[model samples]
Target: MTRILQLTDLHVFSTPGATLKGIPTRECLEDVVGYIQANEHPFDHVVITGDHTHDEQRASYEAVRSILTPWHECLWQVPGNHDDRLLLRQVFPCRSEDGPGGTVNFVFPAGHWLCIGLDTHWPGEVAGVVEDQQLNWLQEILQQASQEDVALFMHHPPVSVGSVWMDAIGLNNRERLEEIIRADPRIRLVCCGHVHHEFQFRLHQADIVATPSTGIQFSPAGTSPQFADESPGYRVIELNEHAFTTRVHRLPVIKYHPAPDA
Candidate 1:
């Protein structure tokens, strides 16, 4: 079995002492990283689903680089609404058969899995979109990998997570995305971040898995923005030849945060 470690929504700020939604975001992220380092799981790859920086500052990105430096060669990153695409590309450069652009989309091999990273971020917008260029590029990869199963990683969830506000800011062109996904029988899993809460939905023979934020988790269910009193978490996925299994690993002690002032 091949194991992949996924950590998302770090929201690391320009300063190490920053906080997000009342949780010490930097410290929380550190805890998650420490856990992975101490654990016995040997990950084939470390996939970060975006929101690497809360402020999108150079310093913030630098902080992120420092945190993941240990696994630099095995790291894969996608940009979130809050991230700077250029900065992300600078910090985590990977070989892509697809030609250059501000958009970062690429495909690579991870053990027996064909891993694909899609960039859905739109500058200055909370929502995301899979543009025509990216769509076309992905279709080509799908055709080429028709004989093998692929796992997609993106910053935004293509499906709604039952949060009215978050859904409003979800991938704007998911219908097109869904069409592409439906066309490819090789797609087995779609892992995403952005909602900062865990969710799963199966579509087009693929499992859409959303991981919780490593810093602040959003309310499990809500229309408006609300922070949840939950521990930071990550996902551990084990992929075998014919099947794959995954589970969310949250901190043992739940961290409490008072509801933001209305």
Candidate 2:
């Protein structure tokens, strides 16, 4: 089994008091790092789905880079709705921008499983897009790897997850994405981030998995203001040649403020 850990939507902020909806973004993110460092299960590979920084600020990038430094040995990340591709590239130079099939579309051959990462980030919008260039590149690779079962990762869920607030910002062209994915029984699992909670749904014949953000978790499967009282979390995955499995974990966080002055 190929052991993997996925953390997404971290939203790391440089400002001491910065937050996403009072989520204590930075403190909570460190807590996630703490959890992984203390855990017994060492990840063979780490996939950070997106939203690595908040406001596209240099400090946010620095904070995220520092927090995830432990996994630099084998880290793979994609851009999200909240990320700037150029900024991300500047931060993680090891990642290539070989257009569609270059850095964004990558493979892990050592694990005996074909894990593919896609970039679905679109600029200046919460909704995502997989443009023709990316789709074509993906198809070309998928066709070439006909014999391999794939574990796909991206920044956006190609299917709607029930969080209405988030659904409004999900993949805008998922049907197009579906058309490309549905026919491939070779796809074992699909993983993404952006919902700020861990969720599972079936898309076509594959598992559409979403890992929680390192910042704050909206309530699990809630509507309206979007989240409830939860710390922060992530997903751990174990993949075989033909199948993959995973579990999500939320770690305790350092509260930055006292109880709301209700």
CA lDDT of every candidate: 0.82, 0.78
Instruction: State model 1's lDDT.
Output: 0.82
* lDDT for model 2: 0.78
Residue range 10-71, candidate 1, lDDT tens digits: 99998877677667787888788887788746787888888999999988888888888778
Candidate 2 matches the true fold with a TM-score of: 0.90
lDDT tens per residue, model 2, 159-184:
88877777877787678679888887
Model 2 residue 76 CA deviation in Å? 0.3
Backbone clash count for every predicted candidate, in the order shown: 0, 4
> What are the RMSDs of all candidates, in order?
1.9, 2.6
> Which pairs clash in model 2?
218-227, 218-228, 219-227, 219-228
